[model samples]
Target: MTTYSEEMEKLGQVTIFDLLPPSPSNAFSIGDSVRVVITVESDSESYHYLEAYHPIVLKKRGEIIEIQGNQQYLVNFAGELHVMKEHEISF
Candidate 1:
């Protein structure tokens, strides 16, 4: 099986590896505009690809968490709140 560490290593290495946790703050915030970027570790058919998929952060958490921790944010998508990752958004 692909280990969780292995998966995180691939997912975290793409810039976020250096920015997570106490060293630096997350790149986004509530009411901030963000676009979904194509990533190697992401599914190509994700909702982020749609032109109208742009979203605004509704809530944010885990700024002081570790790099590999479950830091996440809530975004306004299709009138619903969805949890999103730091890498899943682009400023």
Candidate 2:
């Protein structure tokens, strides 16, 4: 039987042990409360502030989207969902 770790490795995905924890290693996890440190500028044509320094709950971790290498996290605020980079939030 293929173990979870082996399956993840075969798919070219890093297993938990392969990652170095961020500075505040114990930072935040799914369901943890977080806050926006800066407003996220929309990537679309609409010129609007996505969010400010508002309290939000960590929802889920998203896949790496670009070559710049920052990972995105799903957060919920005011019953709305938004994606923000790790550096853009505070726990």
TM per prediction: 0.40, 0.40
Q: Best candidate per lDDT, number?
A: 2
Candidate 2 per-residue lDDT over residues 49-89, each given as its tens digit: 33223233323323322222334666666566667677666
Model 1 spans > 4 angstroms off: 1-23, 39-42, 45-71
lDDT at 69 for candidate 1?
31
Please report how far candidate 1 places residue 42 from its true position, in Å: 4.2
TM-score of 1: 0.40
Tell me the whole-model lDDT of each prediction, alpha carbons only.
0.52, 0.52
Clashes of 2: 0
Cα lDDT of model 1 by residue, 28-84, tens digit: 656765544544356555544442453332222222122333446665554555566
Clashing pairs in 2: none
